[model samples]
Every structure is written in C-alpha cells, then in structure tokens.
Target: MINIKRLTTSDADFGARLDALLAFESAQDASVEQTVAAILADVKTRGDAALIEYTRRFDGLRATSMAELELSQNELQAALAGLPADQRQALEAAAERVRSYHERQTLESWQYVDDGADACGTLLGQKVTPLDRVGLYVPGGKASYPSSVLMNAIPARVAGVAELIMVVPTPAGEHNPLVLAAAALAGVDRVFTIGGAQAVAALAYGTQTVPQVDKIVGPGNAYVAAAKRRVFGVVGIDMVAGPSEILVICDGHTEPDWVAMDLFSQAEHDELAQSILICPDAVYIERVAASLEKLLPTMPRQQVIRAALENRGALIEVRDLDEACRIANRIAPEHLELSLADADAWVAKIRHAGAIFIGRYTSESLGDYCAGPNHVLPTSGSARFSSPLGVYDFQKRTSLIRVSPAGSRILGRIAATLAHGEGLPAHARSAEYRVDG
Candidate 1:
C-alpha cells in the first residue's frame, strides 16, 4: 500500500501539518543558475554561432547554419496533414474552442471625456494594444505538447500579436508531429528547432535568423526556467510553473474508483505533482484509499504516480464541507474540483483557485485540453494574486490623457501643489507653466 499522508482538521497540530505539506522549496539550484547565466551571456555575445554550438552540444543536432534549424511553413502544414484522422480532428476542435474562448477576452481601446470640477473636458482612458512579437518554447523530446501550443499561441493570436515564433528542441533531429501541426493551425509565424537556455537567449536578444520577441511563453525544463528567471526584465515570460496539482473536494457521493483516478491524473504528471482529497466522510475516504491500492498496478506510469502520492499527496478529513472550503482558500490550489452533489452552490465559497472543475463528470484533464479555457494556470499557490494565461497577458494597456486648455488650468494647480510638497521644483514649474489665471 502507498503511504499518502492523512490529516484531520480537529487535531491540534493540523494547521502545522498542513503548512508543512504545502511548503515546497522552489529556489533554483545554484549550479543551474550559474550555468544559465554563462549560457545567456554567451548567446548575447555570439548570437547564431552560440545557438549552433549549443544545439550540437546539447541536442546532438549538428547544423552548419541557422537556416538548417528553422522549419518551413510547408513542413508545419505537412505535419498537420499527416496526422491520423482522429488526432487531426481533435486538434482542430480543441484549437477552435480555445480560439473562441480567448476571442471574448480581447481588450479594446476606450476613451471618455472627464468633466469634473478639478478637470473639465479632459480626455482620459486606456489604449489597449497587442504585443508585436512573442516566442513560444515547446518541450519536444520524449513527450508531445500540442495542447501547450494551442494554450500559449492561440491567446497571443487572439490578442492580435503580429508574429509568433516557436522554438522546440528536436533532440537528435526528431520532431513531434503534433506540436508542429498545432503550430501551423495556430498561425505561428516562424518555427526554430532549438532548446534550453540558448533558445530562450536567442528569443530574448535576437540572433541572425531569429527575430527578437517582446515576450516568451510556454513550458520547459529547469534550464529553461532558470534562463527565463535570469532574463525577466529583458523580455516578458509566462510564470515559472511548478508541478501539476489537483485538490478534489468530494462529499463522498462520487464513486471511490472515480475519485482515486482523478487524483492519479495529476500525480502521473511527475513525482512533484500534488493530489489531495478533502471530504467529510471518513469511511468514504477509506474506500478511496482502497481504490488507489487496487488501481495503482494497472496504470502505465505507476511508479511516478506512487512517488507523487507518497511525497505530496494527502487525504484530509474535514469537519464539514464549509471547513473544507475554508481550507481550500488557505491552500489556494491550482486546480480545484467541487465533487459535491451541490457543487454549484459551493463555488461562491471558493475565492481562490487557478481553475475550478465543477461536478463529477468535469475531469481536470478536460480543462487541460479542450475545455474552452487556457490550461496554463497559476501554480504553487500563485492563484491568490495571479490568473490563468489569457489574451490579457499578450495585450498592453496604455493610459490616454488629453488635457484641454480649460482642464489644464484646473488640474495644473493640483499637480503644482503636490509636486511642490514633494520637493520637485521642476515638476511644479512644468505644471505652473500650463496654468492660467
């Protein structure tokens, strides 16, 4: 039997135990940071030469020039065309749903005249604009992530981003067709077969072939995360995501096997992933534990699932559903499932969560793929302040201010007073210059 932690809310040490479980040391390794810094500086200095060298050294894909590493539009389309009918249909359907959902999130420029006592007839508002170019880094070796292409690229496209350049490491010159196909379908402008810190650097500081992008988004290994962290101010990046997580609040009515499998879905992502179950029923929790024991041997990725469950997973018995919701707020999990009979009623109680999978039928896996919502959610308790990746992440908002002659006189005095109080004579004088008696 696997050893998943069990917690009871009534215990005196419950809070301390919960805190211990939630605490994950996220500091980057010192060696990884040092290596990333060196790689970033090298790429900034050598450009495409550094890229070629890194590709050969790390990915074992020997190439003479940058042109040899970039994939043509024809190749991308061919990948999409060659997919089996079912895979092709699924990709298209998921892409369409993701596109449709994000289209609603597009921000438009708006302005209004301010006719108040302090400022009369002053035009003030916000001008929304999309990023010029974005770089998407898709992990490409052992596993495939067409879903990530749709999640990251579609939002940028929906926000009217001009160019989307994708970089995926094709180790030993092997490419995942699904990723390329998704790129073609999502309207990516350019595709580069590069990986690791070098790919991030090339995108951040523009090489001979790869154009500089305003932002870089998508998932990668620790090297990529370290590189993104190092070059944050130089270029925008999506969050340095943690392992996958799922918090299921079942009222014990759902089938035990179903609950067990739901936990396994996130656990199979990796050993660091967390899967927690909070219910008011004790016997029901035991049934679920038995189900986990019975089902473990059947999974293809059983070792990973077992490790994740033993390390970070938990089965907590709360006082009631209300207590469960309160605890859920404290944890602020990435993916929360309300598996209660009255799941809709409890949604109001959940103020924090990257995504809430409502009802028993709505699996967390659906949201990861074709659920009409971006699966790139805030992880590691970041949902408290951050949000899921969307078109908003790709759009910039600029404040628009047009001071009329009458409004300038009224607003100038306020500005001058404040500037003088702050000991900024230049600011005061600048505002005074625009003021009239």
Candidate 2:
C-alpha cells in the first residue's frame, strides 16, 4: 500500500498542512549556474568550434563539420515516410488539429483613426507581426516526444514565424525518427543535432553555421533548463516548466479506476510531479485509493508513480463541491479536471488553472496530445498569472501612434506638465517644442 497524504477541510491545521504540501522550491544548484555561465561565454566566444567540441564531448558524436550535423529536407521527409502507417496518420491528424486550433488564435494588425479634437485625426492602434525566427529544443536519447515537436513548432508555423530551427541531441549519432518526422510535417526550416547549454547558446548568439533565433521554446533536462534561465534576456523563452501537475475534482460519479489512473497519469511523469483528488465523498476517495493499489502493480513506471504519490500526492475530503473548488483555486494547478456531473456549471467557479479538462471522458492526456490546445501550460502555481502557449506567443505587437499637428499640441501640453512635475527638463522641452499651448 502506497502512503499518500490525506487531508480534510475540517482539520484545524489543514491550511498549514496544505501550504507545506504545495511548496516546491525550484532553486537551481549554484555549481550548475556557474557551469552554465561558463558554457554560454565559451560558445559566444568560440562559435562553431565550441559547438563541435561540446557535441563530441557530451554526445560522443564526432562531427568534422556543422553541415554534417544538419538534417536535410530529404532526410526529414524520409523519416516521415519510414513511419508505420498508423503512426504517420496519428501524427498528421494531431498536427492538423493543433494547426486548426492555433489558426483561430492568430492575431491581426488593427488601426483606428481617432477623430476627437485632442487627436486631430491621429491614427492609433497596434501592428501585429510574426517573429522572424524561433529555435525549438527537444530532448533526445531514450525519451522520445514527437508530441512536443507538434505542439511547439505548429504554433510558430500558424503564427507565420519565418524560420523554425530545431535542435535535438542525437546521442552517438542515433536519432529518433519520430521527432524528425514531426519536424518535417511541421515545416521546420532547419534541424541540428546539438543539445545542452551549447545548443541554447548557439541559438541565442549566432555561430558560423547556426543562426540566432528571436526566441527559443520547448523542453529539456536540468542542464538545458539552467542554460535557458541564464540567457533569458538575451533571447525569448517559453516558461521554465516545473513538474507536471494534475488536480482532479471528482463528484463520486466517475469510475474509481478512472480517477486513480488520472492521478497516475501525472504522477508517472516523475517523482516530484503532483497528483491530487478533491472530492466530497469520503467513501469514493477510499475506492480510488483501492484502485491505485490494484492498478499501480500493472504500470511499467510503478516505482516513479509510487514515489510521486508517496511524496506529493493527496486525497482531500471537502464538505461539498464548492469547497473543493475553493481549494483548487488556491492551489492553481497546471491541469484541473472537473470529473463532475455538472462540470459545465462549475466552470464559472474556477478563476485560476492552466487548462480546464471538463467532463469525465476528457483526459488530461488528450490535451497533452491531440485535444488541440497547446500542451505547453503554466506549472507550479504559475497559472495564477500566465497562460498556455499559443500563436499569440509567437507574434509581436507594436503600438501605433501617429500624432497630427493638432493632436501634438493637445498631447504635448499634458506630456510637458507631467515631465516637468517629474523633474525631467529635457523631456519637458522635447514635448514643449511641439505644444502650441
């Protein structure tokens, strides 16, 4: 029997216990930071030489030239062709759905001419444009996530990003066919076999061969995360994700096995990932615990699931569904599943969550793969302010302001007043020059 924490809202110390359970300090190792800083500086200084050296030292892949590491258009298509028919169909179908969904999120430029006397026919609005280039990082070796390729690349494509460069480390010159195939389908402009801090550095600061990207997006291991954190201001990055999280609110109507596996789905990611069940029915919670004991024995990643459950998982008994929602909003989990008869009705009660998986049949895994929303979600309580990655993330918006002669006089007077109050003489003079008042 696994040891999962049990809590009840009626307990006097429930709030404090919940706080202890929810705390996850993501502090990076000081040694890792120092090492990342050195690597970044080396890559910036040495260029292709640093890349070639690191690739050989880390991946044990001896490459004479940068050209040798790049995957050609032909190779990408061949990987796609080589896939089993079923795999190919699934990938393509998922890609299409992701593409279709993100198309709706594409932002367009808009302008409006203000006719107010202060405006003097000034045209003011915003211009939305696609990023020039973006770099995507995919983890390689034993872990193969073609789904990540589809999720990250498809959005940039939908947003009209000009060039998409992908970097995946091929250990000992061995590559994952699925990843390359997905890249091909997603229309990635370039592909390189590079990983670790070097890949991030090369993308942030251009080398002789690899081009600098406006933004770098995707997932990686600890070293890669450290590197991304180090080079944040130099280039754009998607969120530095925390462990996968899922908070399931069941109404005792959903199957016990389903609830258990739903918890397991997130827990199986790693030892730190959290899986929680908030239900009003105490008996149903016990049944779900029983389901966990029986079903955990069958899972291939049972050790990991067990560790995650024992360490961070929880089953909470609330007075009612309303109480469960209150706790959920406080936690602000990454994946919030409303496994209730009236899932639709409770949507209004939810104020914070990365992605709301409604109804019993809607698995969080579906949203991770083909459910069409970008699976890249805010984690570790970041859902309180952030959002899922989308086409809008790849598009840049510029404020448009055209001050007419009449508008300049009216606006400059106000600007000069504020600037003078702030003791900015230069600013005041700059605005006063245009102000007729």
Q: Candidate 2 on 94-206: residue-level lDDT in tens?
A: 99999999999989899999997567898999999999999999998877699999999999999999999999999999899999999999999999999999999999998
Best by TM-score: 1
lDDT of 1 at 337: 95
Once superposed on the true structure, which residue ranges of model 1 sit more than 4 Å away at CA?
Answer: none
Candidate 2 stretches greater than 4 Å from native? none
lDDT of 1 by residue, 1-437 (tens): 99999999999999999999998999889999999999999999999999999999999987989999999999999999999999999999999999999999999999999887777899999999999999999999886699999999999999999999999999999999999999999999999999999999999999888999999999998999999988899999989999999999999999999999999999999999999999999999999999999999999999999999999999999989999999999999999999989799999999999999999998999999998999999888999999999999999999999998888888899999999999999999998998954
Model 2: lDDT to the true structure = 0.94
- Where does candidate 1 clash, by residue pair? none
The residue pairs in collision within model 2 are none
Once model 2 is optimally superposed onto the true structure by TM-score, how far is the C-alpha of residue 427 displaced, in angstroms? Answer: 1.5
Q: Native-vs-model 1 lDDT? A: 0.95
Model 1, TM vs. native:
0.99
Candidate 1 lDDT at 250 equals 97
